[model samples]
Target: MSDTTNDTDAAGEGTATSDGDADRPTTSVEGAGEPAELDGLAVDEAVERVRAREPDRDPETVRAALGFVAEDGVVSRDALRESLKLTSKVLTTAETRVELAGIALDDAREAAESVPDLPTVEARLEDFAAEVAAVENRAAALGEDLQAVVDDRADPAARFAVADGLRQVDERAREVQRTADEIQFDLEAFERWLDSHAVRVRDLGEDLDALAASLDDLATAVDAIEAASTGDAVETAAGEAGGNAAADSDAGVDDPARAWFDATCSHRATGLTVADLRAELGDLRTWADREGADPVGEGGLDDLAARLDDLDGRHGALGERLDAAAEPEWTDRFGEAVAAVESDLADCAPPVDWGVVQSTVEEHRADIGSDA
Candidate 1:
C-alpha cells in the first residue's frame, strides 16, 4: 500500500496542476537515507555496469565520483542505477533535440527554391549565423559544467548543482528546436524574383560576349594583314636578283605593305577598345555604368538592351575599319565569326555559362587565324 501510494504521488495524483500549487521535481539532497539496495552491491560491479551501458562516457570520472559517494568502499547499487538512468535520460533528450534540429535545418535548406535579392538574403542569413553562434556558446558552457561535475566529485551538493545546470542546457536546446520548427521562409516567391532578374543579367552577358567576339575578329584581321605584308616583303627581297620579275613584284608587295601599316593602326585602336571592354566585364560597377545603365534598378532590362545597342554601334564601327584594311577575301571570315557568335547567343538560355561562350569564341577565332 505504501509503494502504491508512492507510485500514485509520482504520477501526479493528489497534486495540484495550478500555478503556485504545482509539484516540481527538486534537486534537493535532503532525502531520508540512502537505499539498502545501493548498499548491497559491490562498487566495482556497479561502475562496470555503467561503463558497459555508456561506452562513450568517461569511466574514470564515474568511478571517481562513485568512490567519493561510497562510505568505507561500500557503494549503493540502487543509487548507481538511478544516476545512470537519469544521466542517460538527460543526455538522450539533449542529443535528440540536436538531431531533430539538424533534420529541420536540412529540410529548410532543401525546401528553399531560391535565395532572394542580395541585401535581403544577406540579412536573413545573418540571423541564422547568430543562432548558430549562440548554440556553439551554449555547448561550450555545457562542456565547462561537465568539467565542473568531474572536479566536484568529492562534494555531492556541487555535483547536484552541475546536474541541474545540464538540465537547463537541455531545456535551452529544446527551445531552440521549437524556434526552428516555427520559422519558415517564403523561398518560392524569392525564386520567382531571382529568375526574373537572372534572365536580364543573362541577356547582358550575351551582349557583352557578342562585343568581345567582334574585338577578337578585328584582332585576327590585323594579324592576317601583318602576316601577308611580311610574306610579301620576304618574297620581294628574294626575287630582286631576277631584275624585271622583281620590279614587277614591287607594286603588288608595296600595296600589301601599305595595307599592313593601316591595319597596324587599326590593331592599336582595337586593342584599346578590347581593354576597355575587359575592364567593364571585370567590374560590375563599370558594366552597370556603361551608357549610364542601372542593371538592378527599374527598367533594368531596357537599360541593358540600350547598353547592348551601344555595343552593336562599337562593333559596326570596328568592323568597318577591319574590312577596309583587310584583304577582300578576309571580309567573309569576319562575317563568319559574327555568325558563329549569334548562333551561340541564340542557343544559350538563362544562367548562361560565359566561360563556355568565351571558349567557343576563342575556338572560332583560332579558325579565323588559321584561314588567314
Candidate 2:
C-alpha cells in the first residue's frame, strides 16, 4: 500500500478496494478526486424544493437529507443526488401518511387553517341546542292550548281564554321558529365560510356576531314571554277575572250550534293539527291536514249546515228555564179588565179621555169598548 492512502487519491485509486469494501457505502462525496467548488445555491434551491413539496415531512428526515452531502453550506453533485433521493423518499412517505391518516385532506386543511375558531364552533353548537329547546317548548305549549280549546267549548270566557292563549302560542312559536331558522342558517353559513377560507380567507367573526345577535334577540323575546306568563300581563290580557261572556250572560246560547259559531267565527284557520283541534274544529282540521281524505267520505259543508239547522229550536237547560218563567200566568185577569172598561164607559159617558179608553179597549181585545 502507498504511504498516503488518503481521500485525496485519484478516482480509480480510492475506489480500488476489496469486494466487501466495495459493497459498503461510499464515504466520499461527488467528484471524489477532482478539486471542484461546492455549489451553495444549488443546495439551497434543492432543499427549498423538497420543503415546498413535503412540508409535513419529519424534521429529522429533512435535516438528514439537507446534511447528506452538505458541508459548510456547500454541496457536491453526488451528495446532492443522494440528498434528493432521501428527500423524494421522505416526500413519498409523507404523502402516504397523509393519504392513510383516516381523514380527508380538505378537512385536514380546514382544521389547520382554522385552528383558533374551533372553540367558537363548539360554543355555537351549545347555543343551538338551547335555542332549539326553547323553540320546541313554545311549539309544544301552542299545541296544548289548541287541544284545550278543542276539548271544552262550554264557557265563552274559557274559549276566549284559549283563543288568546292560541294567539300567544302562535306568535311565540313563530318567533322561536324564525330564530331557529336563523341559527341554522348562520351555522351553515359558517361551515361554508370555513370551507372557502382557502379560496378566499374569511374570518368567522362576522357570522358569529350575527348568530350571537339572533340568540340575544331570542333570549329577550323568550324572557318577555316568560315574564308576561309569570306576571299578570298575560293573565289580565287573557281576562282571567272578566271578559267571560258566559259569566255575564245567564243564557248559554241556549243552543250548541249557535254557541260554537258565535265563539269560533273569528278564529284563525291555519297551522292547526289533528290533536290541537280535537272537538268541533278538530274534525275539520284533521280532514284538511289529510288533504281532504275523510275516512267516512260522506259529509260535506251542506251536511254540517244541516246539522246546525237541526239545532234551531233545540234549547239547552237555561233556555228551558227562561221559556218556563216567561209563560202567561192567568187569562181571567184580562177578562176582568175588559168588563171594567165597559162599565166605566157605560156610567161616565163621552169625552172621558178616549186615549185611556182606547188603550184599555185595545189591550182587552174584547167587545167592551167597540163604540169608542
Candidate 3:
C-alpha cells in the first residue's frame, strides 16, 4: 500500500476515528482535503465582505462559525474540512438572516416616521380651545354690560350715550363674527388638506374638536351682543324721551320745541294725527290726479271714498272733543285722517269727484277752525 499510514499522517492531523479504531482505514482522501480548504477560505472571505458591507451588522451571527470551531471537541484535518464546509453553509444562512433582519428594521423605522405625534397635536388643540373660550367670554361680558346700560332709566343725553356705546359694541361684535368666520374657513381648508393626505383620524379629531368648540363660543358671543343691541331697547329709550316731552307740554308750558318734540315722538309711536291726515289727503289727491282717477263712483271706489269721508268727519268731531278736554289729541286725529286718506286713495276710480272732495275739505277745515 506504499505506506498508507505515512500518507494519511502527511495529509493533516486530528482526523475523526472510524467506527472501530482497529478496523480504521489509514489513508489520505484526495478530493476531501481540497474541498475543505477551499470552503474554509470562502467562508472567511464571505464573513469579511459582509462585515464591510454592513458596518452595523450584528457581530454574533457573523462570529458563529468561529465559535463552532473553538467549541464542540477537537477536529482532524478531515473533520476540519467537514467543519469548514458546514461553517460556510451556516455563514451563508446567517448572512441571509442578517440581511432580512436589516430589511425588517428599516421598514419598522419608516412606519414609525410616517405616524403623527398625536399627543402633541392634542395638546396644541387644547391650548387653542382655551384661547377661543377666553375671547368669547370677554365678548359676552361686554354685551351684558351694554344691555344693562340700555335698561337703565336715564335722561335723554344719558340714553343717547348708552345707545352710542351699544352701537360701538355691535360693530365690534360684527368684527369678531367676521374673524370667527375667517378662522372657520381656514380650519375647513386645513381639514380638506389633511383628508387628502390621509391623516390619522385621532389626530384630525383633535383639531376638528377644538375648531368646533371655538365656533360654538363665537356663536354664543354673537347672540349675547345681539340681545344687548336689540331694537326694542332703542325704542324704549325713545318712548321715555317722548313721554317726558309730552309731560312738559301738558304742564301748560307752551314751549314750541317741546310741543314739536312731543308731537313728533307721539305720532311715531302711535301712528296718529290731524296734520298727518291732511298730508295723506293731499297725497291722495295728487295721486288721483296723476293716475287720472275719480275719488268716488263705480266699483269699490264710491264706497271707499264715502267711507273715508265719514271717517274724516268722525275724526273732526273727535278733535272737537279733544279741544273741549284741552287734551293734545293731535296724534290720534292725525292717525285717523291718514287712514281715511289712504283708504280713499286706494278706492279711487277714474273721473274723481273733485267737487265733492273740495267741499269735504272745506267742511273739515271749518270744523278744525271751530275746534281750535
Candidate 4:
C-alpha cells in the first residue's frame, strides 16, 4: 500500500498560455509515492532497479525511472536513452545505414529535380520513404524492448528466486506506471465524451438513486460493523496486556490497503485519529477472525463504508477538538503515532487487494483514482 501525498502538476502545465483556470487541467492531492531517481543506468539495469525498488514510489516517478523521460505521449523520450545505451552498437550500425540512405536520397532528389521524369521521381521517392520508415520502425522496436524490461516482468515471486529483489522492484514500479496510465486514459476519455456528447441537461433521477443506494449501503455496513465488533477473545488471549497492544493482530491482518486509501483518497484536510483508525482496523481483524468468513473478499461495500465513516468521524472530531491554535503540539503527537504504525507495519508485508480498494469507494470520490 501507499501513503498520502500532494502533487501540484496539472494539465496544460508547461504549455499553459492563458491565466484562466478553465483552460488548465490540474490535480492536487497527496498519495503514496516518491519520484524515482534512475539516471546513469544501462537500460536493462535501470529497468531492473525500477522493479526492485519502486513499489512505494509514484506512478509518474516510476515512469521516469523506466526511461520514459520527462516528456510524454507517443513521441516522448520514453526508452530512447535506455535503448541507445543498451543497443549502442546496433544504433551505430543503423545510423551508418541511415546516413548512406540519406546520401542516396539526396542524390536521387537532385537527379529527379534536374530530369523531371515521373517514373524516376516515383522510384526515388518510394525508396526514400522505405528507408526512413525502416529506421523509424527500428527505433520504435528498440524503445519497446528497453521498456519491456521495466514494464513486463513475470508475476510476483514467479521469478523471485531467480530475480532476487530486482524483479520485485521492477514490478512495483511498473504497476505504478500502469496505474498512472490507466487514470490518465480514463479521465481524458471522460472529458472528451462529456465535451462532445450533449445528451441531457439535467438528471435528478440518477442522483436520487445514488443517494438512496448509499444510504441503504451505509445502514447495512453499520449493522455488519456492530455484529463484527462484539469482542475478540483470541486477540485478548494474544496478549492485550504487556506484549505491545499494537502487536496483537493476526498475521496478514495489518495490511496497508485502508491506510493507503485514506492517505491517497480525496476530501482529506485534517488529522484522522490513530486510535479510531485502530478501532476500524480492530473491526477488520474481527471480520478476518470470523469462522468461514471471506477474509480476502473485503466484505460488502457498506461494511467498508462503515469503517470509512468511522475514519471520517474521528477526523471531524479531532478537527473540532483541536483547532489551529495548538498546531505544533498536535502535529508532533500525530506524527509519532503514525510513524510508530508505519514502522511496525513495515515489518509485516501483508498482501493487498489494490484493485478492489481503488475502485470500491472511488465511484463517489470525483477523480480520486486518477491523476487528473
Displacement of residue 249 (Cα, Å) in model 1 is 99
Worst 10 residues of 1 by lDDT: 1-10
* Candidate that would win on lDDT: 1
Segments in model 1 whose C-alpha atoms lie over 4 Å from true places: 1-85, 99-116, 154-163, 166-170, 176-372
Ranking of models by lDDT: 1, 3, 2, 4
Candidate 4, run of 10 with poorest lDDT: 2-11
Question: By TM-score, is 2 or 4 better?
Answer: 2
Clash tally for model 4 = 14
lDDT of 4 by residue, 138-242 (tens): 544543443443332221111112122223333443443343344334333333322321111111123224434544444343333222222233445546554
TM-score of 4: 0.20
lDDT minimum window of 10 residues, candidate 3: 152-161
Q: How close is every model to the real structure, measured as TM-score?
A: 0.26, 0.23, 0.21, 0.20
Please write out the lDDT profile of model 2 over residues 274-336, one tens digit for every residue.
112122223333333444433333344334334333332221322232222221221132334
Against the true structure, candidate 3 reaches a TM-score of 0.21
Off-target runs (Cα >4 Å) in candidate 4 are 1-162, 196-210, 221-372
Each model's lDDT: 0.45, 0.36, 0.37, 0.35
The sequence of per-residue lDDT tens digits that candidate 3 reaches over residues 1-372 is 011112333223343253433333232222332111212233445345435544575555544432332224322234333433343333333333333433433343344344343332333334434434554554555445444533331222122223234444444555555544444444444344323322322333343344345334433433333333333345456587774432222223233222322222222211122233333334434444554553354432334335445544544443343233222433354445434444444332322333444454444444444333
Can you give the lDDT of residue 89 in candidate 4?
41
lDDT of 1 by residue, 252-330 (tens): 3334534443343344333334444333333433334553545456545555546655665665665565555555444
